[model samples]
Target: MNLFTDIRTLVIASLDAMVADGALPDGLDFANVAVEPPRDAAHGDMATNAAMVLAKPAKQKPRDIAEKLAEKLAMDDRITSAEVAGPGFLNLRLAPGIWQDVIGSVLAAGTDFGRSDVGQGKKVNVEYVSANPTGPLHVGHTRGAVFGDALASLLDFAGFNVTREYYINDGGAQVDVLARSVYLRYLEAHGQEVAFEDGTYPGDYLIAVGEDLKTRVGDAYVGQPESVWLEKIRDYATEAMMDLIRADLASLGVVMDKFYSEKSLYGTGRIEAALDSLESKGLIYEGVLEPPKGKKPEDWEPREQTLFKSTEHGDDVDRPVKKSDGAWTYFAPDIAYHYDKVTRGYDLLIDIFGADHGGYVKRMKAAVSALSDGTVPLDIKLTQLVKLFKNGEPFKMSKRAGTFVTLRDVVDQVGPDVTRFVMLTRKNDAPLDFDFDKVLEQSKDNPVFYVQYANARVCSALRKATEVGLDVSDAATAAADLSLITDPAQLSVAKKLAEWPRLIEIAARTNEPHRVAFYLYELASDLHGLYHLGKDNADLRFIDEGNSAATQAKMALARAVSVVISAGLGILGVTPVEEMR
Candidate 1:
């Protein structure tokens, strides 16, 4: 159960009672009232801002409202004390039995203890890691992949219907470059001496694709020009690169529910349909776009072209949808793609892009806004660069040298769990340092290890208790008499456990997966602290040599911690460790 939400409900109910008794005026706005953890744990278990928010509206001072609200809240059995702090902030200390019951609730819920229904089953489409099909995914895309996957999982946990998507950018000049590069390799497969052009890919990853093409069609077009073989090899090579990209994502535990192709939008009437929707709204026009301010191209002459009135929807200026040669520009396909998403009846859209695409955010948002008439909202998250380090030096990567750090490289060294956890230890828009030497260390400084160790400790406690003939199974813990768990240290862990459901809601609302990482770290810290306390105090241990009642109560607490940890790790797409090696 969410104790914070329950306490907020009580706060609102008491405010209604005040209105009924004329202690507070009728129609007083209480929308801003909030119940949350106190800034300082020493202040109390929970704090509310009801008095401060309603004081001015009710034409009363904050302290006066707090005093009356405190008296009314004190009548509830769950709240032991409600004391006013500075400027009438109400700090609440809960009854001991309430925290005691949280342990039993956690054990009953198991790994689903913290799952929330805050999303209300809204359809959320998350698009991410649309890396170009030119090469293998590098260290930078790894961060976005991990962040986006974890975020999708977090939203799913909070009750959103999440769809993970990848957009294949196969309709660009980069694909032409890829085609030429594969042709060079194709000639090499036929034993011809060929050199990779300056604009072509030279990575050894594509050599196998060239060899495979020979295997499939033995010596069919060995000496042909670009006209006979370019289109065939382009399609073949793009598929190979996508397979490589998919494998890279699989290594990091990222699986896309859908893969959308840019080339498909070319032949379909989707682009025209999206533009026609904009045209009906008077957002499309024929005009000449001014050269970008402060930077002009050599071909800077004004030319007639089709444009979208993006400025009306908050873009700096109208953007060109068609080039002077009458072919669709890059922005055209993007507009059409988002329009397709809106037509598919998604309630919301989220795109995870790299920081370099920061300038593209406003235009994309404007497209979705204009397309859906503000009915569908789009949220774009840009993940910043990741700097890999080893022994305090900037690590170097070169695909041509076959020494690049792929997603597989990182996951192979530390495994997917460590790679995913360490990638999310920072905010998405901030630079993250993935140090090879530091992350694998078995110490508190390594957050992944620390969190895993907490789960392992709980497993160890259950094993020890079982060895001593204590009933510590899920059925046993669920039916345990939890009132015997009265120690302050034990209750502290229960209080943390009570915050899990609230944590999931907040993290999902803000679309911040790093908050989940931070919460897991704090929860792990509390679990570890309680475990260490058992060393000096025999009564705090999970197993009591002669008392089954006490043993069951303590096992309930330990199992409860494991339950919450497993839930948090599930959201992160990391499996909890049964034992630490």
Candidate 2:
């Protein structure tokens, strides 16, 4: 069903044929040869760099290779014309029946049309939105959550065994602050006034947790000092906040496969084990790092510390694992965590971090590389911040969170589907401006609405066809005489549909789900363009009034578009609206 792959297979076979005939060298490497859509659609259906890539290796000119390869491809029934374009690129025009076959395949495959096996069932762990359990998830976490969830889905669609995870930062000083903050709320629930200091969380979202704690142990911990109740309340507060976080993620249609606790790495030999793994390889040592790279030496002081030789693995400099005071640095627990992931036998590890953690990527990768002995690869994707606007003005803070907009604020406002789509409109590494007013508009400018409207419009056409007593089942539509769909506009949509399987492999390989959003937008644009053209040209209409057979053929194309749209939106965690409100 992957037309591009099929054609590429043919192109490779042609190159091998040349090798066998001694027309080209015997030992030629064709790994880099690729058959993809031509940059200019007017050129041909596909363009291959086979001739150019094999030219220097085969000791043959590119044009000579392409001209020879073109004749070989021309013998295939699928290729209508294999022309030598430019120097060595072979532009291939596929037979029209191939495009028609793509539509029938889409209708037959339903939402599974573009599913791929590029991942080969490799085990992968995607860790994201590891926000501290201090409050509700904020705007930044919202973007990470959507991006991570969609990425997990994309990897799954591409045949990766994916585990969605969240790392809790409950072992840090932040959770102690959370415990103190909740104590104030607990006092307030007991009819005593309380004030939130600079270090405490002042959000009103914890009021319920406070009241519930009061109901559980009424006045028991009221008179206790910090030592007596700190540990107990810290556990209680972290668990409560995690529950709140789970609710927020559920509202956004996100659910993690596992929740890892950073505290578990403490009071245990896990940190030592992770370090020992590196030390055994001569990668860990005690040393004083050079002072700040660009700073004056007079302003810097060097202290001997236990450090990991991260520079050997690709980091810019060696990183500290334990400080001079014999206390583990923040990087130690992270190292232990990744070591655990490696020992668990995952083939790949992916961490989705906020843009603010950009500097941490190199060290994390080096740690994993050392721990896994270069057997497992790690990819860290940093999701940039989201700037929210309302009616063209910058969005304000949330009262519930008391400082930033919470995930609930967005899910409650736009609903989960629109919020997820808008979050993915931009690449995860690029800053996104989410205008509440703009995303909700029923216009082409709003990708969320535009894509949904195309699906709903297709449903309307199907319903109207059904009212005329015409069979609109998928089987009937797929079995229609698709050759009747000869219009350039109708065929343009089929061409886009044919690109689905190819797009899946590319997007999955890049780990960029934004490409799915972009493709869906383009497909929607093509569908909408054809629908509008029908207004001026009667032949372009989806449902011909006089002939049921013609209408069915066109409906096959429309339904095929919807099938792919639904699949793309589903991969994006979006629900296609059946009818526009």
Candidate 3:
């Protein structure tokens, strides 16, 4: 059903025919031969670089090869013309019937139109939004959460066995701080005035947790020593904070398949086992790291430490597994966690991290490479900062979060669909400006609104047709005489729909879900363009008065557009609107 792929297959077949007819040499490796949309639409509908890529290997001039290839391709019923453009590129114009059939194909496939099997059922682990389980998730974590969740969906649509995961940072010292902070709140709940010191959390969200702790254990652990209450409170606070985070993610429609606790790696021999695996490969050593690049000699302290030869696996330098104090370093648990994932038999691993963790990428990759013995590949994507603007000024911090806006703050302002779509309007590594006033504006400039409006408009058309007693069911529309949909504007939309399958494959291969949002915007534009054209020309309208056959033909195209939009938004974790308010 992929028009582009079908056309490419024809192009390859024609090249093979040329080799047989002695128009070109054999063994010309068509791996690099690509059939894609031409740079200028005025040139043709599609372009191929087969002649240009095979010229040197075929021992023939590119223009000569293109002329013969064009003749061979012209014999096919699908291609209307194949003209040789500048030097070697062969620009192709498909038959109008082919574009019309694309609409029928979309109706036949429904939301499954663009789903691909490029991933081939490979097991993929996508770990994202692994924020510290100390408080509700903030804005930075929101972007990572949305990105990771959408990526998992995209991979699933592309036929990967995806596992959405969250790695809890509960085992770190940060949890100890959270416990002490909750202890202060617990004292306040016991009618004792407490001061939140600089190192402790002061958010009002913890007030409820403190009151809940009092309800669970009345007068127990009251005025107790740190030794008696710290451990118990740490576990309780971590669970409460994780509950808050889970609710926050639910508001935005992000659900993880697994929540991995970093604490599980400790006291479990998992860290030692991971390191032992590395040691067996001669990657572990006892060595002193060189002084940091900018550190002065007098300020530097040299000590023998247990290190991983990360440099051998693409890291900038060797990394320490244990500190001078003989305790595991911060990276030790991360190594163990990834090693655990590697042993889980996943074929691919993807980590979505905040932009600040860019420096951690190489070392983590090196760890996975060493642990998997270069078998499993790791892809790390960093989501950049989100700047919020309201009333044409910088948005204020959330009082509930104390230092930043929470994910719930954004989701509450605009519902989950708008929040999810607007967040992905920009590339992951590029900084995004989330303007409260702009994204909700019902205008073309707002991408989420534009795309949603297109689907809504299609729904309106379908409803009007049904009211007029025209059968617009999927089966009926798909069975319409699509050849009657020959208007230029209608064909334009069909052409864009043809790109969906190809675009999904490209976005999945590059691990970029933002491309799906971008493609949806373009498709929406084409749908809108066709809608506008119907105003002046009654023949171009989706519902032709008194002509059921013509109305069904055009309504089929409109319905097909909605199908693709729903599929694209589904991958983005956004619900398509039947009607935009």
Candidate 4:
């Protein structure tokens, strides 16, 4: 069903025939041989570097090899012509029927048209948006959440067994601050005036949690020491904050398969067990780290500590696992968490972190490498900051979140579909500017609107065809005689559709779901371009008057475009619009 793949197979077969005929030498690896669209449409429909790649290896001239290969490929029915270009590149013009078949394949497969088995069912764990359970998620976490969720969906479509996960940072000092903040709110709920100190959270969102604590215990911890209420309130506040975070994610259509608690690693021997595994490999040691670079010897203190030989596994330096106070360092729990994931038997691990955590990437990867003995690979993607603009100026902070804009703030303004689509409009590592006025504009500059408008246009065509009594069911459109779909404008759309399967494989392999959004925009452009051409040429219109056969043939192409758009948007976790208001 993949036209490029089908053509590549033919190209490879033709090369094998050349070897048999003594036109080329044997044992030339074809791994580097690639068939893709020509850089210029004026050159040809597709281009292949097979001749150029094999010429030096086979001890033959590139042009000579290309001439022989072209003759061999000309014998195939699918390739209309193959011509040598430049030194050894071969440009090919496919038979028009080949493009027509791509349309039929799209309709036949429906939304599963571009689904690939490139992943081969490997188990993949994607951990993202592991923000501290202190309050509702912020704009930075929103980007990570959308990126991770979309990546999980893309992997699933590419045939990977994906698990969406969230690692809760509950067993940290931050949670204790949250508990104290809630305690202050609890006093206020008990008719006592309280002041939120600089270290405590002052967001209005915690007001309800404080009131709820009053209802549950009726001020049992009132006027008591921190020892009596700190632990209990820490647990209670974490649960409440997590509930708020879940609702925020739900607003954006994200649901995790697992929520791992960092607290579970403590008091459960898991941290010790993970370190023990490392110790058995001679990677653990008691040593003093060198003074950090740029520090004077007099200003630096050398303390003996328990360290992990992280540099052996690609880190910049050895990392300390335990502090001088005989307590676990911050990196200890993270190492244990990854060790736990490796023992769970996942083939791959992907972590989506905010841009500020870029320094943590190497150490985390080293930990997983040491834990899994380099058997499981870890890929960490860092999502950069999102700058919001409204009314031609930088958007202000949310009052409810106190310091930043919440995820719900963005979603409530533009709704989930626009929010999700706009977040992915840029690469994960590149900073993004989310302009409220621009994204909502119904114009070509707006990718979300452009893509959605294309889908809506297809739906409008389908409804018009139905009114005219043309049968446009899936089976009927798939079985329509596509030979009449020979117009240059229509064939261009089919050519774009042929790239869907290849696009999925590439995006999944690179772990970049933003490429899907980019591809959808290009496909939508092609669809819209063809739709605009039909205004002047009646023959190019989707519905031909008084000719059922011609109308079905044209409508089939329009329907096929919608099928691919739906599939692409489905991977992005955005619902396709039937009509754009």
Candidate 5:
């Protein structure tokens, strides 16, 4: 079904034949040989660097090898012509039937057309949006949530066993602040006026938790000491905040398979166990790290503490696992958490962090590497800031003004589909400007609407064909004589369709979900272009009005495009529109 993979197989087989004919050396490495679309579509449908990669290795000139390879490739039925372009690049023009088959294959496969097995079922743990469970998720957390969810879906489509995870930072100082904030709210619930000091959370979202606490305990700890109420309120408040956070994630269509509590690593021997594993490898030591370069904290001085030899594994400096006060540093719990993931037998680990955590990247990777002994790899993706725009003007977020945008605020405004798609339009490391006016605009510039419009138009075509008594059922399209689709415009769509399987592998390998967004935009463009062309050419229309065979052929293409759009949107977690409202 993957025409590119099939064509590459033929190319490799021809190269083997060349080896047999003594035109190339025996047992030459072919891993670098690649079959990809040429930069210019007019140059060819596909091109290979086999000749260029093998030329110097085989002790032959590139053109000399390309000429011999061309002679061998011309014998294949799929490749109509193989021309040696500049610097021995072999550009191939595939037979038109190859493009024809791509359409039929798409129709046959339905929405499952581009699902790939390149991952071979390796277990991948993608941890994202691990924001502190202290308050409602803000706009900053929304970007990480969308990126991680899309990445998990993309990896799943590429055949990786994906586990969507959220690491709850409940064991941090922020949760204590949350506890005190809720306590103040609780006092207010008891008819006491309270002031939200500089350190306390002033958002109205905590009022409910405070009232619920009053209902549960009914004045039991009304004027007690900190010891009596702090622990109970901290636990209750943390759970409530987590419940609210989960709902916020649910609003965006994100569901995590795991929610790891940072508190769990505190009471148990988990931190010690992770450190012991590192100690056994001589990566743990009692040492003092030099103060950071340039502007060191004035209070910072040489202090021997529990340190991880992260420098050996490529960190800028050896990092402390324990503070001078003997408590575990924040890095300690993180190291143990990733160690637990490695021990759970995942083949790979991916962490989606906010851009501010860029400084934590190297040491985190070093810790995971030391824990796993480099057996498992960790890829940390840092999601940059999302700037909001309203009416083409920069939108402001003010915590003191109590006008901070929550994830719920965004989903309520645009709905989850538009939220997810627009969030992914930019690369994770690149800053994104999410303009409210532009996203809802029903134009090509609005990718979410444009892609959805393509799906809606396909549905319109099918409904019209049905009205004209054409057999446009899934069963009929699957059984249609797809060979009748011979127009150059029709085949151009199928050629774009052929790139899906390859696109999935590339996007997954690069951990870049923006590629999927870009690809869907291109596919939607092709579908819309083909639909607009039918306005002038009656033969290109999906509903022929008289000839059932021609109508089936056109509907087959339209249906195929809709199927691919649905599949791509599924990866993006967007529901395809059946009709535009």
Candidate 6:
């Protein structure tokens, strides 16, 4: 059903025929030959660089090879004409029946129209939104969460065995701060006044956790020192905050396949084992790290520390794993954590980190590389910040979350669908300005609304067809005589639909979910254009009073648009609206 792929196959077949006739050199690698849409739609349906790519390798001029290739390709029934454009680019015009058949294929496939098998079911691990278990998730975490979830879904749809994971940051000093903060709230629950000092969390969200602790075990640690209660309260507080984090993710319709606790790696053999694996590979050693050339060095002498030879694995320099004091550095657990992932035998690993973690990318990749002996590849995608606005004004931060807008706050205002869609409207590495006033508006400027409106319009067409006593079921529409859908406007939308499977493969190969959003918006624009054309021309309308076959053909095309829209929205984790409000 991929017209581009089918056309590329024809192009390759014609090139083989040229080689068979001695018109082109044999053994020329044509793997780089590509058939894609022309830069300008007015040029042709597809443009291929086969001649341009093969010219130098075949020791022939591009124009000469292009002329012969065009002649060979014009023999196919599917390709109406092939013309040589500037220095050997071949632009191809497809037969009208091909576009008509694309609509039929979409109807037959339904919501699974664009699903791809490009991933080949390879095992992939995607870890994202590993926010600290100290409080609610904020705006930046929401972007990563939405991006990560969509990416996992995209890979799954692309035939990858994807596992969605969240790493809990409960092993750090921040959790200690959370524990003490909860102790303060616990004391307040005992009818005693306690002030939140400089290191304690003062958010109102923790008030309930403290009250819950009071309800669980009252009067047990009221007057005790830090020794007897610290560990107990730390575990208790970590669990409570994880519950809060899980709830926040649930509100956004994001579900994780695994929640890996950083604390579980602590005092466990996992850290020692990961370091042991490196040591066995001669990657671990005791050394001193030098500072950058331009930066002023610290007023201290070199000290022996356990380090990993990350420089050999593409990092800028070797990194420390253990300090002089014999304590594991922050990098130690991270190495061990990723080693655990590698040991589980994943073909690929992807981390969705905030833009602030850009420095961690190279070192983390080096760790995974050294851990897997350069077999498993790791990709770290950093999501940029989100600046929230409403009515041309900056949105205020939530007092409950202290400094930034919480994920719950954004989801509650706009709902999960709008929040997820707007979050992906930009590239993951670029800053996004999410305007509440603009996103919720019913105008075409709101991409989410526009895409949803296209689906609703299709449903409206289906309802009208059914009202006229025509069978609007999927089976009926798929079997409709599609040659009746010969209008240029209707065929234009079908051409766009034909690009869906190709776009899915492109998005999956690049590991970019935002491309799906961009493609859906473009497809919706084409659908809207065709629907508007039906308004002025009665013959272009989906329903015809006398001919059920013609009406079914037109309605079939409309439903195919909705089918692709639903598939795209499914990957985005956004609910498709059958009727826009």
Top-lDDT structure, candidate number:
4
Backbone clash total for model 3 is 0
Ranking by lDDT: 4, 3, 2, 6, 5, 1
Residue-wise lDDT of candidate 1 within 1-581, one digit each (tens)?
A: 78899999999999999999999999988788999999999999999999999988899999999999999999999999999999999999999999998987787777888788998999999999999898788888899999999999999999999999999999998988998888777778889999876778887887888888889988887878889888888898999999999999998889999999999999789899999999999999999888879979887899999999998887888889998898998999999999999988999999999999999988998899999999999999999998888788976675642546777767767899999999899999999999988999999999999999999998998898888787888788778888898888898899999988999999999899999889989999998898788889988977787988888888888888888888888888899999998
Error of 6 at 457 (Å): 0.7
The residue ranges of model 4 lying beyond 4 angstroms of the native Cα positions read 296-299
What is the alpha-carbon lDDT for the whole of candidate 1? 0.90
All models, RMSD in angstroms: 1.6, 1.2, 1.2, 1.3, 1.4, 1.3
TM-score of each: 0.97, 0.98, 0.98, 0.98, 0.98, 0.98
Give me candidate 6's TM-score against the actual structure.
Answer: 0.98
Deviation of model 4 at 71, angstroms = 1.5
- Per-residue lDDT tens digits for candidate 4, residues 420-452, read 999999999999999999989999999999999
The C-alpha local distance difference test score for the whole of candidate 4 amounts to 0.94
Model 3 lDDT per residue over 1-581, tens place? 66788888998999888889888877779999988989988898999999999999998899999999999999988889999989989999999998998888888888999888989999999999999998999989999999999999999999999999999999999999999999998989999999988699999999999999999987788888999999999999999999999999999999999999999999999999999999999999999999988756896789999999999999999999999889999999999999999999999999999999999999999999999989999999999999999999999999988888999989989889999999899999999999999999999999999999999999999998999898887778988999898877888889899999999998999999999999999999999988888889889888886898999899999999999999999999999999987
Model 2 TM-score, all chains together: 0.98
Which residue pairs in model 5 clash with each other?
A: none
Model 2 pairs whose backbones collide: none
> Residue 209: error of model 5 in Å?
0.8
lDDT measured at residue 275 in model 2 versus the true structure, 0 to 100 = 98
| Cα lDDT listed for each candidate | 0.90, 0.93, 0.93, 0.94, 0.90, 0.92
lDDT of 2 by residue, 247-291 (tens): 999999999999999999999999999999999999999899988
lDDT of 6 at 182: 96
